[model samples]
Target: MTVEEVVSMVSLIEELEAREAAARVRVEELESQIAELMARLEAERETWSRLRVTRETVAEVVAEMSVPDTAGEPGPEEPAEPAPVRVVGAVMVPHWREGLLVDALPDVYRDIVEVVADASTPMQAKQIVPRIGLPAVTAKIEGTPGKLKRLVERGWLTEDQPGLFALAHRATVESGEGAER
Candidate 1:
């Protein structure tokens, strides 16, 4: 055809190419954003899955610890051992009595209770959990200082030192729950 018509067609083609380049760049940007969002979703999903598993395991451990071998019940694939006896308020009480005293407790507290009772000496909260078989954490209970501190609140136990606890005389009373006033 004529050069002028050919030039006009070429200009239109160039403009179309520019638009296609802009569309390609936009597509690339959207793809990058989608990739980042997907990565974040995966990380969040992994965190939630880990937390769910942790909650289930902790619930099982606490339930198993709640009853222990206080009765004739076999526990946790481990043979039940007779609770150690200690003189509290001039009466003998199971050293693991604290384990039986509370209905619910944090895992570290449950671990600390059994651990402290079996320990050679009454230990502070900081010392008891680590020395006995618990994850040592300086982090205090929500409103309390440590395991012994919470046990003292339960009234079945008493704190002898800052973070140490001893079973109360009430631990041996007829109620057997240390609810003694």
Candidate 2:
């Protein structure tokens, strides 16, 4: 064959090889899809059978509902007192203070934890902020600088660097109070 014809044939061979590779990939994808569809079909069949059984039971119950009541109006033969409601076991512990704390902070802070406990080097509050909560990070970082400085003095937080305050661990702050437990 001529060089041009040979080159053209080589290019066609390469294109055919690429197409065959693509077809193989498509076949694998189709086989996986078939497996998933078969699984779904089996589950659907089981659910349909369950629904049919439920419908049959409901039909029997509906037939029972149509039966005439044995008792008409009872002429003052019934007892006067109604039954008392019953609750079982260690039913509830009403921690009102914890409820107030939870209400004070929007729920998002539940996820947020400012890790100030036992690290060789202190961490920045900004990095710790994302670790703490979703509601708003402002609980650890908010308000005017003067007020914030006062909060820092009050030991609510410890500034690791400028514009960065690591939340003082609750245990450290609560240690002085009898509520420390």
Candidate 3:
């Protein structure tokens, strides 16, 4: 090759190498960012897991409290009335009873109860999602079934069929008849 041609090729190779180095730097930066994001995601997942366990544990404790103690009556020293439902960090689902009103539930659970009570026929989780002012997106829709199942477990709602949900036995608060209960 001619000397001039060789010089030009050398300059082009230098530019290409510079570009490749910049690309490698950019890749490293992205990898670092990805690693940070992955760590944050894992921490978030752990928090979510802990919160779920807390919720389930609270539900179990509430259920146990609701069951009438068959062993014996409270001694004269102990109060005769059952302990009132307690609200901890997040309001827990209480076992429904004659005097337990829908208003006592957490906002979302209350909304779900009201929606099911309002529906003429039993409704599915997807159908209930939008009625409570939530977007009917797949994530919300998919998440709702778990709430519905929890409500069923807590006696706030019933699953007449596989997916269809209805109020367990209570009327809506708006009705005023069973509002206090």
Top lDDT model: 3
Per-residue lDDT of 54-138 in model 3, one digit per residue for the tens? 7866766766766567358788877766665554554567667666677777789888988888889999988999999999997
**Candidate 1 local lDDT, 1-181, one digit each (tens):** 9999999999999999999999999999999999999999889867876775566446445544554455657768756665433322221212334445532333455455545555566666665645655456533321124335545654546677766665553333323333422
Which sections of candidate 1 miss by over 4 Å? Answer: 67-181
Clashes of 3: 2
lDDT-superior candidate, 1 or 3: 3
Clashing pairs in 3: 100-181, 101-181
Candidate 2 stretches greater than 4 Å from native: 68-181
Ranking by TM-score: 3, 1, 2
lDDT of each: 0.54, 0.46, 0.79
Least lDDT summed over 10 consecutive residues: which range in candidate 3? 172-181
**Alpha carbon lDDT at 81, candidate 1:** 62
TM-score of 2: 0.35
- Enumerate residue pairs that collide in model 1: none
TM-score of 1: 0.36
* Global Cα RMSD, each model: 15.4, 19.8, 5.9
